[model samples]
Target: MPGAVEESNRRLLRARDAMDRRFAEPLDVPTLARIAHVSEAHFIRTFRAAFGETPHRYLQRRRVERAMFLLRCTERSVTEICMDVGFSSLGTFSRVFRDVVGEPPSAHRRRGPLPPVPTCFAMAWARPATDRAVPEKRPERLRP
Candidate 1:
């Protein structure tokens, strides 16, 4: 049983590694499933089980992380960074960037370049907080 679990984890890691390498490319569940050698549904379920997020969300976070680094380190326009990070639309890029980083890309950029700290420390400090689940919006009650 432990061996089976390890094998499953290895497969998931392989798919996730592909995602990390090709984040700038248009990737989909079918391609990832093929990489994992699993059905699409099973891959999604097990990925979430292992990583605590869907593969799509994981990829979005990865792209946003790269965008964050670029925003801090380079003077490229937000739209350019958006396209470079594989987001096709500026609007979508802004929205997702905001969602992941808790600020718009321009605002994040205004913070200026990363401090002269170790790269690992800088990345650890700036990584988006994805473990906390976003709360669902509740309907407001009508007053009598």
Candidate 2:
């Protein structure tokens, strides 16, 4: 309905694409703002207005999500998966994974087919037929 809004969304999508390319690099507000052709202040506000979270937090969550997938699907070590997902430190990755997935990565693995998690991530790992029904927006990047 809003044609002008399409341009802003395109800008946001461009910003999101750029973010995907340079995710491992430091993604500061000014950098993302420059990519979006918006002022840093406005970029922060606008991105959040459209996506529902701050830039940095979104990035961290994406990394964590990728790590979760790797943990579940691959035989890679936690440290390898941590670095593969752009986490530089084992301690930090473990803490963040625990925070988001709500359990230790090893414990989650040890749980076997039963899976290790609280209701949130467990709900995610569950294979409900309605999986296609959810609409997940790209999360913003993590802060330094």
Candidate 3:
């Protein structure tokens, strides 16, 4: 039974790796499930069990992570950064970024990049808490 559980976790990791590698692509439960060789329902359940967050949330978090880097390091517009990070709509991107990071993209960008440090340390420090509730929608300010 432990071995079976380990195998299930491995499969889930494979699917999650695909998400990490292709975070900008359109990904869905069905596709991820097939990658894990499990049913959609089972994939969702097992993925949550293994990873502590749903696949969609995981992907969104990944996208936001990338966007955070881009926002802090580049002079790109918020819309460009949003689309670059795989969010199709500016409003949706702003909303999700707010939910995950506790502030809108513009605000985060204004704060500037994290101090020079090891990439691993920066990423770990910047990663959002997955269990935090998505905040209520607010009027997004897209200005730099």
Candidate 4:
């Protein structure tokens, strides 16, 4: 059972690595499923179970991460950055950017270039909050 689990994880990692490397490409579940050597439905289910997000959501987050970096580090126009990050429509790109980063691309870019920190540190610091688990909501106390 452990070995089977390991093998399944390995397959998922291969597909995820491909997504990480080719984030700007038009990736779909079929291609990712082929990479994982699983049926599309299984791939989607297992991917969500293993990674805590759907493959499409993962890909969108990856793209938005890259766009966040580009927005902070480059002077490229928002439209160019949007297209370069694999989004077909500027409106969609802006919407997703806002959803992921909590702000539009131009607004994020207005913060100016990243400080002169190590690339690894910069990336880690600039990473969006989507990867973290959301805290459970608590009920409010009654007021007097």
What local lDDT score does residue 66 receive in model 4, on the 0 to 100 scale? 93
Candidate lDDT scores, in order, read 0.91, 0.70, 0.89, 0.88
The digit string of per-residue lDDT tens for model 1 on 38-68 reads 9999999999999999898899899999999
Q: Which numbered prediction scores highest in TM-score against the true structure?
A: 1
* C-alpha-based local distance difference test score of model 3: 0.89
- Residue pairs clashing in model 1 are none
**Local accuracy of candidate 4 as per-residue lDDT tens digits, 44-63:** 99998999888888888889
* TM-score, cand. 2 vs. native: 0.68
Off by over 4 Å in 2: 1-4, 21-25, 113-144
Estimate, for each residue in 1-144, the C-alpha lDDT of model 3 and write its tens digit: 469878988899899999999999988889999999999989988887888888888899999999998998899999999999898999999999998999999999998877799988988998888887654334489998
Q: Which stretches of candidate 3 lie over 4 Å from their true place?
A: 135-144
Which prediction has the highest lDDT against the true structure?
A: 1
Residue 22 lDDT, candidate 1, scale 0-100: 97
Clashes of each: 0, 7, 0, 0
Model 2, position 31: C-alpha lDDT score: 81
Task: Predict model 2's lDDT versus the native.
Answer: 0.70
